[model samples]
Target: MFLRFGFVVGQAGIIGTMAIVLFSNAITLLTTLSLSAIATNTKVEGGGAYFLISRSLGAEFGGAIGLVFFAAQALSVAMYVIGFTEALVGYLPDGTSPTLVASLTNIAVFGCVAIGAAWTMKLQFLILAAVLFALFSFYAGAWTQFDAGIFLQNTGSGFSGGESFWTVFALFFPAVTGIMAGANMSGDLRNPARSIPLGTLAAVFVTGLIYISEAILIGGCRDRETLITNNLVLSDIAVMPALIAAGVFAATISSALGSMMGAPRILQSLARDRLFRWLQPLGIGSGANSEPRRAIFVTFLISQAGILLADLNTIAPLITMAFLVTYGLLNLATFYESITKNPSYRPRFKFCHWTTSLAGAIGCGIVMLLIDWQWAFVAISLFAALHWYLSKIDLSADFGNVTSGLLFERTRKNLLKLEGELYHPKNWRPFVLALSGTGFSRPHLVVFGHWLTSRTGILTLGQVIQGELDDRHRRRISQERMLHAMIGEHGLNAFPAVVVASDYVTGVEALVQCQGLGRLRPNAVLLGCPLSVDRMKIFGGLLRNLRGLSRSAVVLRRTDEPADDWKPPSGTVDVWWRGRANGELMVLLAHLLLQNEDWRGRELRLLRVVDNEAGIDEVRNHLNGLLKAARIPGVTKVVVSKDPELAIQTTSRNAAMVFLGMQPPNIGDEEAFFYRTEKLAGGLSRVVFVQSAGGMRLES
Candidate 1:
């Protein structure tokens, strides 16, 4: 592709343009160094690039890249087998067909791999020897015809084939990618940590030197027109043309055999982690050495179909993008580890630096876009989608994913910065500790917690398992697991936490006082109102404790029945404005809920109940001023009624939720206040009495 686009120097001028070999190898050299750095730091086992990335960046990213890497390797198998077939057909008698040769070659390669990785690896040595001999013969023959004066010939194609330098780079870039052929055998090696870096880098250096030599040979030995017209210039100039053919066959077959062994191992690793549960069958091995024979058979089927159906040019760009993306991610993973300066990042192979990893990442990205922006975007999008899917699966693996460590480091730094800063009401976000039993029993309560903390803050669902102190300790682990499963089943972002206590009151007291590390301590508490008055007394006591702790509280009670379909509440949110702290907190929460996409178009009505018509205008103006200053988009109203409970019920009957202010339940003999609160929410959907301890004012 590069030669057609005028990117390459003509054969006679290749000596001048030999830097292309350096340029290509430079990309791999960066990857090799970065790979070596990470491999040495971590205990890398199988999955090759996938294992390294997942261990650093986490499964979602690792799984996504693994999918792409597997495809690239599998397609490489087809590409190589077809390459061998092309060489064989080139040297065959007139009656031989290319398709038949390709089919037979694919079968042979697949059969060798099916025997297992042990035999395939053994065969590689013999193939490598043939490859070396062929290279020797070609160089010897080329040197006999070589002339230094040929370097001065015109090498530009002048867009003869409507291709550019980037297109050429894309085509030839895959040639330098054979470095991974050794790295992919990491699973088979007993000491991948020691061997991968040494073996991979050595191959890269040797291959690079060979490529540069070939460029010089082609430039100095062959004519420009002849090189331009015939890509088989190596065969033409070789001392024995047949040796060139034999080398091509050996090289392509070796690559095919390598991929056949490597790709399945990736699939096996992915399945072992249950990243995609449906793919678990691929992880089952049939050999005593745990050869991925099942995975191998699957790989063979995929390659066979590609060999028969795919065109080489069509598959080339895809393979290029996949490898480029993998290389970029690998570098990014190492760069993250280095920059974070995590104490765990010490590598046995210490030659790597953060700057090099970053450069490698940037180089991979730039080349991906430069080669073909369209394909680059497509490949990136596909990986992003895969990551999203894997994240949803919540594949359980302890890869020591780097994101957690990065978060920890950043959080520590931010906490240190925050220590010197003064606390402000404007920065207050609801870090809520919501008490609940089961989501199935209290669906509305869970949904309410989600809405309150949707995008702005953290909401942890705290479940207190009441039992004898001794037995509670024994059952805590099992109970926590069940609680976590419930949280997962409900698909809530809210964390599930369980604590055991001797009694309900003690449990509530402990949960209310509990605090997470650093700034993660809960600033608010939420709970569903109990049906019985006795149960209400228990919640009332919890509220009193929370008030003393200076934590905001929300007690919710559903007065209106849920829809028969039982979907989450969605509609208008009504907030009753009293004044100062309580009103501001209630309105702020309602507005925060509006910020979510689900509640975007929903109404937020700020309502005030006045005793008579005389105070109606004043209240409306005050409420309007508050709304304007707070910048909360909502309607304002004043209801002049003798019975405020009737007014509230009528105004917010169809609303999704109603927020009402109550005098601190623990402060006064608020039986009348409590009675009126229940009466007001009698006909409303879901009513929450919000009490703000302090720090509730808007920025004004």
Candidate 2:
């Protein structure tokens, strides 16, 4: 397909193809660096394209771009499938055309490939090998017909303009588009930090070498003018039309598969964020790679749709636009990180000066804007829409999976806060949120408490691995490997830096206390309840002592709904609200209403008060006054009463929930008292508690 569609770089000269390679290489490098910054700070998940960008940038922004990327790939894949199959059918009896057969065959191929990894892997390998071989052979053919003089003869490509040289760059730009095939696989690779950057760099260099050599070879053709003007496949000179067309067929197939593979990952990433519910079924929160079965299927269907919409002629422009959009963002991300002096960010790999990348991106964006204004407009419009959606969206509820790394665009500030290096007025480690043990709940608990304070914390997972090493180097490495694999596989790439400490370590007291750690402030430490009694006692004592050393905090308890979904009584989102230590919970009703999308951006009214007696009349009178304040003619009001029993009555009288605070027990038995609270509110209404314990300790 490369040869047929004029993707083969011999369509131009060495300089022309080299230009494309340079741009692709630079763009790929920028993207890799951005992704690396995100990966180092957060664990990567299945949404290969969406994962890194969202983490580095923010999920909302990431989700928006993810949707666009997914759409582009889906469309590109269909184009490839339809085009390739149609060509395959051309080999049938002279009297018959095989387009329909090709479509059916391609659909079967899609089903078989998407159904399982084994088949997909096998097909990918075969396609890759065939294309690699064809590319090699084609380059070899070009060398056999090398022409240095021809390069100089038509360097202008017959375009009579002072900017003719740049015209050549424009003509060969589409060739650079294929480099995304390698870049898009960042999340799938075993070692993305190392392999993603290396593979992309290698792909760029090799592609450049092949393209430049081919350009020189084909440029020197005996009838260079004919090849340039007629747009004929390079093989017209060699007379082996069969072999050349066959090679084209292979390359096109490879391109299509590559596009298909890439698109779904981006879609899957978006779905992971719950941005595109339609695609969520594909990567549906399961499988090793979070395969996103439903998302992949939707992508495949979308691709087929695109294929139907576009024929051989119109598809090229859209695909080019997609590539340009990605490249432009890549350069922009690199530039931002570079100027900001972001940690671990380096521009060393960029092929040219920073200005060059900016220039290239601008050029690409301009060309795209000029070619298909409507499509470009649609893509940009959707991206902006998505970013706005992300900007306001909060993912604290899914706190475990989100890395603090994405919290800010500028990096240096975050590095200090994340690494536990910052100092408050009463500084030490700001607050030690001990991730008590290894379990599904650990990351969320630790990150949450950490968020509450400086996030200078640790999460200890007492995992039952197949080993018996005690803080041994090998054990640590093994754990890291396991964690890396599990984290990536589980798509928890966006997580804080976790140090898997030994459970056998006799005392976590010193570590938890941040004892004698010089200026490294460790205030109060948080611990979970699942540990052995003896262990908790020891850790609890240490926590108390640490408080003496520094004003420490301890919110020790188990979740009432440990492994269950939590729905607080309406806008009562359990906010440790920034301004007010505990803000009005009545707005929770607004939040509940906002969940319906149709009324999200509306004004809200909430009922708030302070009570000491917890009396029924006091609550009802206060609630009634609050309800009066909420009278907005057409708007709705939901009140979650402060008293559980009264709240239940209110719910029956009018839709409402019972909101209550966790009352620390000193007068009565602790367990019995909390258990009574649970029993009391069990069925009255959506009884809720502010999660003061299991969350990232807020820095402020």
Candidate 3:
């Protein structure tokens, strides 16, 4: 009915302007199709656009876009109020002041919205009837004037002055954006699962058909000059101009009231999502009806700010950008849901396709850029900033975002592809089997194992509970609970399992034997230092068994008390290399530990002891070669002393942790190996004794 709005800005002929409308409707149709598909698939709730987006794309994206959608809805209230005021001025006597009429009209509209939603909705139905009558009158009056020759006036001249097709297209786009009217009211609908798809698609089809028919009637009934000259062509063509004016007034006021009501609802939803701490007060509903009084008041203030502006010419582009970006992201979200191939993504609506969603997304983006490149950039930047902030906050909405499913699908495919690929040295990772009973008594063992794995490999905490087969189930459950508590409390990303065995030795054997699966078996095992002679025998036996199973082992003992160091910890890793296979494994483990953020930038020192000062340089040179071959950065220090224990203690006093190679402790002896290592670490920091078997060799 108001197709002439395009002709005032651009000199485009009737058909040229209608082309813009058709394009906009095509996007709206696509969006409607996608929205229907999603609404049918899931249980759509109050958040409307935000609910759909957050549940599909994740909270970060949903929160970010939801903020923009709220602002757009609020600003749209001002836009419609201003339009209503303009229409009011058009009907008044020629002497009437336009500014005074607009100011009073704005106040009346705000008051109507503030009174209550039920009253406004009742008024909405009355206005809708007036709009329908006006639409019918215009079509009826213009039917007699519709001549075949009128269609021949196809010259693409826009306005009497001149304007680009893109400029004209921007103005027409908002007409099609009405498809979201039904979606914004999704919260209040009783049967959103059934109502949203049916209602939204119906609106799109009806509105789309009306706009297309109106475009044709304008082109077929009027000449180019008449279309350009008459800005109020709907009134000029209507049987009764007053009825058309009534339609214009009702349409504008109803639109303004609708946005005024819907904007606050979105704000309340956002506040409930904890999008910002300050928005908490807005989430509180005041009446038995759960009215968003606080949110409504805030929206009123924002609308007043817009109303106070002299013109909406500048704000117009921003509003369009907001809608375009929202539409684009909505399409993108649907596309991800379809492409993820998740079994849960079964949409009840059969017309949905990834191709349709993709096209809609790409179309929105292209149109947004074409309309205004700088504004498009600004819109995207705002979206990105909001997304980054929400991600950092780590807000928990638990909306079953599609990111995890997408990543899982990709990971599965990549792993399958990699199965046939050749192995390489640089790709090697340490799969560690860290044995710590409950992992609580010795927390550092698990922490160090996590560091050694560098988050790129698997680290499993294996606890062996000594119990009889009769009480095995209960004991295993208890041990598993304890293990889980330790893992959670420490914030360690490691899996845990418990085995019930008759004795400690049997438990350790079971743990070592069943550590991992086919290609993911644990290549390294970590253990705590033995405290007694009986434990020493168990440790030696376990070490022998691990060696037979082709695994590397590290026996650790902390000498000094632990410190609460900062992350990417500030300390040194001293590897006391003894020129053996175990020493090689120790150096490699130290290198891997450095890969973790907790150990990043910490010092890595490789120390060796020699009998004389003359051979110290030779030892340093040899260690340097090993460091180069290992492709790890380190400082090689050669100590010229007869006593290596004194050398280790004095040199590693300030180090965070020290690593040294050792032979398995003898059960029959004084357990001197453990005692000697304890004495060596007496005045130093934490220490770990490395013992490597065949499976621990460098990957290359």
RMSD of 1: 22.2
TM-score of each: 0.59, 0.54, 0.59
- lDDT, residue 88, candidate 2: 70
Residue by residue across 1-700, what tens digits does model 3's lDDT show? 4634525223556566667766877887787778887776666766677777877787789999989988888888788777777777756789897666666766777788777777878989999999999888888977877787866664455454545777777756777776676677677777886787888878777876777677667666777676767777777777887788888788888888888788888888888878678888898876666777788888887877787874567666777888888888888888988876433455667787999999999999998888889999998999999999987884756446666545432465554534433332323457788886754556667777877764456688888777786778887887788888877887777878788888877887787777764345677788888767666766777777777777788877764554652243347999998876788778877877776776777889999988898898789998887765454678999888888889888888888778988766554554666577677777775788888874333322
lDDT of 3: 0.74
lDDT value, candidate 2, whole model: 0.49
Question: What TM-score does candidate 3 get on C-alpha atoms?
Answer: 0.59
Cα shift from native, residue 542, model 2 (Å): 15
Candidate 2 similarity to native, TM-score: 0.54
Worst 10 residues of 1 by lDDT: 1-10
Model 2 misplaced stretches (Cα beyond 4 Å): 4-17, 36-41, 93-102, 147-151, 160-171, 182-187, 229-232, 237-241, 277-279, 285-290, 330-374, 390-700
lDDT of 2 at 126: 75
Q: In terms of lDDT, which candidate is strongest? A: 1
- Counting only residues 3 or more apart in sequence or on different chains, how many pairs clash (N, Cα, C under 3 Å) in candidate 1? 3
lDDT of 3 at 575: 96
